[model samples]
Target: MGEKESEKLLFWEHMRTPIAPQHPTLPKLLVLLILFVSLTYLVYTLKLVSTSRACKDAPFSKTIIAVNATASAAAVLRRGSRETNPEDRTDLRHLVFGIAASAKLWDQRKSYIKLWYRARDMRGVVWLDEKVKSEENNSDTLPPVRISGDTARFKYTNRQGHRSAIRISRIVSETLRLGMKDVRWFVMGDDDTVFVTENLIRVLRKYDHNELYYIGSLSESHLQNIFFSYNMAYGGGGFAISYPLAKALQKMQDRCIQRYPALYGSDDRMQACMAELGVPLTKEIGFHQYDVYGNLFGLLASHPVTPLVSLHHLDVVEPIFPNVTQVEALQRLTIPMKLDSAGLMQQSICYDKSKSWTVSVSWGFAVEIFRGVFSPREMEMPSRTFLNWYRRADYTAYAFNTRPVSRNPCQKPFVFYFSKAKYNSTMQQIVSEYERHRVPHPDCRWKMANPAAFDKVEVYKKPDPHLWDRVSSEEKLLQSEEVKGERDHGDRCGYV
Candidate 1:
């Protein structure tokens, strides 16, 4: 065969195989199908690979350094009036009392180191022990050191009496990196905080050391029209920071300290620095920064009982004294009851009133009823005005009378429902009432449900019978005064 003819025949033979389609769209369709499959396979492969470090143990299983910054050494030595034992100066338990001192104003140089060592025997939870150094000295920054398998080296640097919280933070970041190269978390706190070891361990177990960084309360401040975002370091209340975040903070410490020099006096500013580093800050309601007083029971109930990490007592007197042992025992006993009651109260609000709403034997039942049903939507309706009279009248006449008012801040608003059989009748009554008068019947707009929709309905009895005794007496007094006024008016008219 000729070269040109053979070349042309070869091309036609390759193209004319069974794979060649007579239809124009079939090849295009097949190409698209193959491409789609290739893309899917790529995605599946990528999904199986995890990008983060996979530590087999708990995130905070590694040793942690707890740094406490106090105001002065004298404050540590002299127990305030609120101190449980004023005379026992040498006892280590007495050091927990100093957690509330105004370390900002005192000369903390000498005492901060002493208190750090004493805190080593803090309950049964000991993560690490390192000498506490005062931030007062102008020493070069050091890196974290590995002391042992279980114990890591740590340093508590006191920022020398409220000098600058920002500077202290920079010092803390620098100190944390000096001793441990791969610390899972770093804890920053004040002397006044009571550490809950078990709870701290639990929190640490939730995330990896690298994935987690900052653990605290998320807070933002609007001061003088300037909005500042900061995390409330439960860590400050004694929260823990992942090592990655701690290292990042240490690297940024110089820049942060220089940029916000005034912040050295503020704990929140130090946390703001961490936020700037892109470290995720997890806020814990369990870690409280406020004084323990008015709502002690409520506070204890709201927080986790078994895994409490720290308690910051700003008051001079210990709210529950007898040191750590007494506090632990009390918490163990009270926390469970408080949590149970809180749950019961939550369930009570959703109780179906159509069925018997037997109040639970617990005192929390009433609290739950108030929280779940009445409190949330009490003020939802608009006040009555002539222009918006319909809305006001309908709400006042119907919704208010049916649902109880809630007194708890966290409770959801109450709602009333009707059964399927009664739905039409109830709705008809509401419509009839609305047509005849300006105000509609209170039960008019309740949502209707099928009888089988609910497993049960609970009809609540009237709240405690004694609740209105004082109000009733006051009303009687007012009525008597009105009657007397009317009689005096009649007598004057007769005399005239």
Candidate 2:
């Protein structure tokens, strides 16, 4: 009874003994810590998911949008800076010329190259099919000659076209392969093409050389434009490719030319590559392909309101001047060109109300005198003294506006060709003389004024570097003053 009672009492005593409170503060703090950690993890996971979703859904957030906007603005600013920086301007040094020449024509055409080519200032190579005899002893005055890579692999199916077209089309790519440094433009031309280097630079400066530009002009013949692409830059007139574009062409040009077997000429093939690259021709009216026969007087006398960048097919057309070889004529033309390149071949018109005569002055080239008053609009249009490329084609075949050669002898322009110019240092004037081109006109019953009375015309001009800048204002002044007969007087056309 004692042992059983002791065991029961001991068990009762153990059960009745209260357990020590598990340090209530410690347990309560531990539970709170665990809940805090779990709650924090849940909240963090939800926040991470929301952020990921926002990044994926709204990719261009304000920060990202701002970055893109800044990048675009920076690009525009870079372009603007490059264009405006006078030190970064496109000049003779920035141009690399690739002339497409035949060994056969090289001798005859090197003179044309020598005219505009300032060897020390220019970076150029005349790419010929084969080495010419003259190339061995080539002068430092002329561009260095190089033999073109054989293009036997390329196929040419155009019956009317010469296979040399293939080689010519690859000129820019070959030029790029030479790895010219600091070259902004790769200008391509035929051996016969003559460039006014200053005007060429002026024309090039108008465009962004960093961008892809296939700059040139259409053929003078409308049929040529129709046959070829109206959009194609005629290589004979010469064309320029931006450095970036030439590099881009170097990537795909060989493959590109292979695709166009039936294309007629180098320009078309070059244009084909440009088309593949999604670059359209940047037609600058200054480049003259001169795809016509007969006298160039009508064309040159009334040059469009742009710089005369180039002239091609000089051999095909009559000598520009009345009585000289083409080379001599160009040499003579350089006189006024040196004095004022921008004003070269730029036409200015005024009236002599006393004589009821109209005077059109082709600065640096020629002067035309009409007995009757002619609108500036009519005077601006070239007279069709030059024939179209095709003998069968009519005056309407020209790409530009052309007035008919007047059947009435009296209505014909009494021409005065540019002779000599002297720069008077004291006066700061370029005094130029233009002699009468004596083409005897039949006597007309109607008498207005006699242009033949003058043996020579003297033009007094101030050497204006900013001639083109004032063109608009001068034109406006001409319009305003012509009606009042206060712009120009007989035998003396004052600057309006």
Candidate 3:
């Protein structure tokens, strides 16, 4: 055969019968193995992703810092344990505090840090739109400046109105995404609010962080409660969201915010969002939004038996404690509270029909005891008198309410002021001394007709500065009249 024809025949022969010299199946088998492994990994990743989605909605476990975690506690029974690696009760971590500070007032966090922030053993982080760059090197601008203010657009949005809600929602997302997986309770508060960390933890201990808890107090004023639902916790007093709820909020908040564009306040917007999730405010009396401006003795004197968690509206009111500024009050609260004074001032308002007295105890004021228990048809100023030895013996030496009647200054007849008694003091002890007396007998009234002048009898007067001398003198005159009548009644009652 010719050479070319022979070469063609050899090529055809080689193509027809593949070489058995090497294993051709090896590379194909390797590719198949690689594909199989890749498929298995992809399935595993999808399962993990699905689990994480469900976990975001599942109830999460929490621990209190310094408070021991008990593994024996009943685990939160969730519906979908089908997760290959479910989070068990074995996952216990400390109480976590996530403070979402607005861009405008991040600097003012000093009060919180110095007061209650450092005392807590739990985890905490102040989430801000962006960290502040020190401007000490830059000349102080000719323009006025606040301690915690900036002009950045992002900062303003994070600190302002309904837009701030977006900031909070994002903080929750970022906080969890960046690995706060162990955080159980996420506490949210403003720049001015002061929390009693131990009391906060104590209060939180009462509830399971695993369950949904939107805990806080309502506004003290009816007008505020009218504007903001009493069902919502006033953010000034601060509020807590369970880890699960916070995560759930992270997912639902943006959509919720879109639904409520009219809500301009961060707190109210959050309330609306939580409402969408069917979570109502768990009213706790210990959280106080001292939304008033004046002495707190009157109200704090009557605090209830619950732990005091927070005090809001810092500089809005001064002298929250007797003779002390808001900062001073914050400092004082950090000191251990006497067990007897755990809950001093409660949100108490009651009218005694038998005695015809309308008594009320507020956060920063003394117990207001009014003679006519009935609500006024219209606002009326009943004549008011403030003079009694009892007044000298309270948390304050004198004034129970510095700004009584607010700026309106409502006066009532025989208005008696007394220092706050112990929280556990009986109703009898709490009432003003004049209130303790019943109507005088006819004979006693007649005898008091010859009411002696102050010069004629021994009397005690609260020492006052020249600014208060005139007012104090007038009060003394009222005291003289009331004393004589009381003396006549005492004689009639067989007292010496």
Candidate 4:
């Protein structure tokens, strides 16, 4: 028994003392394992923090930059020494353009006209223009602008004229350099196209400074011409450029100018360069670049159409301005015209004299009068029910006759009187009752009579007498069955 107790005490002591590892490398192995895990965790944490900060501080994802290329040929010729009007030197905010004199006169004229019109319309919008004229004849020499550490030159061969796409590109580059801000968004468009100023302003106002670049108004034809290998095809009349996108374009411009100088005629080529530089061209609608002649009318007629950015009226110049001005002036007029009784009688006689004519004749007169006096809010068909309910006589006598019948309170009648007896609700009911009671006379066929002619007649129909009784009987039966089922279930379960 003493030996057994000693063995128990020895076992307890063995349990209390820590066991020494048989392999000396075990402790070292454990220490190394722990150190490795700690180092890995520390490295991972640092990397995560660094990545998070880098993402947080990044600039706006995209910004809208608008570039206009519609400066006059004269403006282009005076590029080198173009006078900088102290007043014209507003901090070049958001517009860019290139001017060149030696290009084809036709192209220059078209571009110039478009540019001037757009500028006039986009008075409040931000834009930039690059002077492309020669400094030789001009007295003023503005500070030289540089791109890629080189003095940018707007060069054009005199013979190539409008056919020379190189000069146009040079003008575009000069404008872009001057207009681009540190912001991310950008736009490039020709002068001839009409831009909705309010719509653009509204979009820019809501645009987040940090987001992907968006190009508006993509055309399928332009897309086809662009090589997808470059991953760029924002085809349309105009496109927006992000700051990152702009930088990418600037980087690729030199290479593109050298490699695909022939592609300069197409704006899609410039877009392709951006694509090659890893800037994505987002396909978004809103930028329209087609010859939109009819679109102007639709835009003007729109409910809240505001300032138009650009309008290209190749023909009929005075119609837009003069008509718009006249309408505006009319809107400000508040003249109150009164018609004399003699004048009303004469108008009524004239209308009555033409009553026998065809519907087209009647409609023509109505439309002419409508156009002259009242502009209908919009085109829509007349409501059939309303027209039928208010007879033409009632419309002429009461609705259209705006004048008071009499000045004295006692002189006016509560009800109107007419030569043709007025048909009212009381007269119609009696006729319906008479018809219901009549049996068919074999010899005399019944003809529908005007119920309005008769008065003080009442018509009544009997209600179904058995409906309520039948409903009550069904309800009682359903209730009784439900109660019986509940009792049966309870009895089967031995809980009743």
Residues 105-162, model 1: lDDT tens digits: 2233223223223234431122122333345332222112212121112222435434
> Candidate 4's residue-wise lDDT over 1-496, tens digit each?
6999999999999999998868688899999999999999999999999876845654444111111222333343343132245332222233332222222233333333332324432222212133344344212211222222232443323342332344334334444565545433454544333333333443433333344464454332222333222233332245555555555456567666555534535354565455566556554334433222221222222212111222332231222212234223112111100111111001100111121110101100011011011112221211111111112313222111122223332222111101111113563411111111122222312232221232222212122212112223446689557644643332211000
Q: How many residue pairs clash in all the candidates, one count each?
A: 45, 0, 15, 32
Per-prediction TM-score to the true structure, in the order listed: 0.37, 0.80, 0.48, 0.33
Each prediction's whole-model lDDT (CA): 0.37, 0.85, 0.51, 0.32
Whole-model lDDT, candidate 1? 0.37
- Which rank order by TM-score, best down to worst? 2, 3, 1, 4
Candidate 4 regions with alpha-carbon error over 4 angstroms: 1-163, 167-173, 179-185, 206-214, 220-236, 261-264, 291-496
* Regions of candidate 2 where Cα sits further than 4 Å from its true position: 1-86, 134-137, 469-496
Rank order (by lDDT, best first): 2, 3, 1, 4
Model 4 TM-score is 0.33
